[model samples]
Target: MMTPATIDPLHTPLCDLLGCEVPVLLAGMGGVARWELAAAVAEAGGYATLGMVREDPALIESEVTALRAATDRPFAVNLIPSATDPALLEAQIRCCLDLGIGAFSFFWDVMPEVIARVKQAGCLVLHQVGTRQAAAEAEQAGVDVLIVQGVEAGGHVHGREAGLDLAVGVHAVSRLPVVIAGGISTGDDLAAALRAGLDGVQCGTAFLATGESFAHDYHKTRVTAATGDDTVLTDVFVLNWPKGAAVRVIGNSVTDALDGRLFGHDPATLPRDAIAWDGDAPRLRFSTDSPLRTTTGDMEAMALFAGQGAGRINDIPPAGVRLRDMAEAARRILAQG
Candidate 1:
């Protein structure tokens, strides 16, 4: 058998490693992950992370400032090295260092020099990997933690297998503490993963429905209303975003129009049925939304990122409340066993 794990919220290997009360962590959702949400998650006893790519240097600094202004607890900054420009990534890392960021979660494989620099600066590094080979390489590079991302994850996914499959597969090869991402919405999922040998769980979509998230109300409302079947994985946003990574989004007019084809449509050919108002003006689009608070289109028709476990999420509460509920439920379930 594998190592025994817990979701007690008092201390797991993850909690002891990261100095957080709970093993649950907020997934760094890029543009969707803002300072408000990050601070609240950290304050709620789970580890939080600032999504450190996508935006420019100034914006990242500002968000770090915002996060600091809100919470004194430790948090992380996540970067996708494969998708981020190297120079920008370096600058962002430097800025984070100056800002006193103690924890960082990196997407993609870890580079030796980069990991060296971050570690030298006294930051603990968590590398997210999609395969066993990548996990082995990360451990070789001295990654303090491993985040196993599966295809069922919302936002961007790197693994061909689902979360549980990858956790088990990677566990067989490496002994690194594993935290799973993808379709983790409830306590049952957390309990199952821990019992199967994962050290922790990082949930994105269910947390997106929490009050502190910067997502528009329309988007949050829709997530609470959705079931697992409502999410679909696609690379349709390649023009303005990364090219090949699978982004799991809720089904809407845009996804329906694409019909599972990635690059067959002209932008002009999209239907303008979904509408939202700006004072006296009406905005229309099939989908150009990243689901920000500023999004003013029919959000259901926009790119609403969600995982398959979204079906189990039924309410919108504070981040702390959600964390407590999941932890309590997991503790109870683990107690029975």
Candidate 2:
């Protein structure tokens, strides 16, 4: 199905390592990459990732089980070094190996235990890096893939501003497949990244708009309705959590109020407890204290994290339909040659 103009043959080291059909990858969108979404991507012939940033040991195992049950295709698990309790991580890794997860996505520096276990389990390691230096270090650490994330990415910014240089950085260091994330939403964007020699594209904003995403309906709708200027990167809300880190989110009344104290805001300024969504329906809102509410519906002033590409989103579709559509579009564009 590859075309002359289409760089479908550009399966770099990571895709080969993970055994995915396309170099394209789902950027482990935290709660958004639930079983349904993950399986859908795999079914559509892309590598799907389940993010376990704030997941508990039991919940992680269950989700992994569900993903495996949904599809026989390969899928990945994303582990956040900061959020994962060491003991809990060990348990989760054991479960991943036991269930035979195809790949493991890492968020921080390659820790020895993580590296050792993942390699021992025969899983490919997809290491995420925010900077070129970190990308090189990850290569040295022996990651099978290098994810070059930019400041335009949702969630954590990783303290880098090289939005345009994301793919360039990855190509500079490792021979592995390089996936460019942050603010990428369209075929044109994907094409541009590939033309820059990137192995593939990993996107969050567009996937977040998919119907299969576990994100609250309110949040999904908001992202779809957002414009180019609707998003802003701020560390204000995320820094308020107990294990707070920097995150990029849309600016809201609550976030706007904290502009003066972006780095200095007291945790008290955020909702003391989780925002109470009245209906059984998901609530989309920015909740510094609750990670679940942040993803699954409840879009009232909640910390709805989205990349700048959110501005380009306009509709919601199921994950399978969306992935197939994108693939078809890419195929068409490539065929033009």
TM-score of each: 0.87, 0.86
Q: Candidate 1: deviation at residue 270, Å?
A: 12
Q: Assess each prediction's global lDDT (C-alpha) against the native.
A: 0.78, 0.72
Tens-place lDDT per residue, model 2, 1-337, is 8675555644455566677776678888766788888888888878889977767778888898898888988888998765566787778787777777767888855575667678877778888888887878778777888888888888776746665586686687668778888888877676677668888888887888887788777778888888757776665665323333567777777677764555554444544444445345343333442234234333456777788888778899987777767766666665565
Error of 2 at 70 (Å): 1.6
Worst 10 residues of 1 by lDDT: 1-10
- Per-residue lDDT of 191 in model 2: 66
Candidate 2 TM-score, C-alpha based: 0.86
- For model 1, the stretches where C-alpha displacement exceeds 4 angstroms are 1-10, 262-289, 298-301
Which residue pairs in candidate 1 collide? none
Positional deviation of residue 46's Cα in model 1 after best superposition, in angstroms: 0.6
For candidate 1, the per-residue lDDT at 87 reads 87
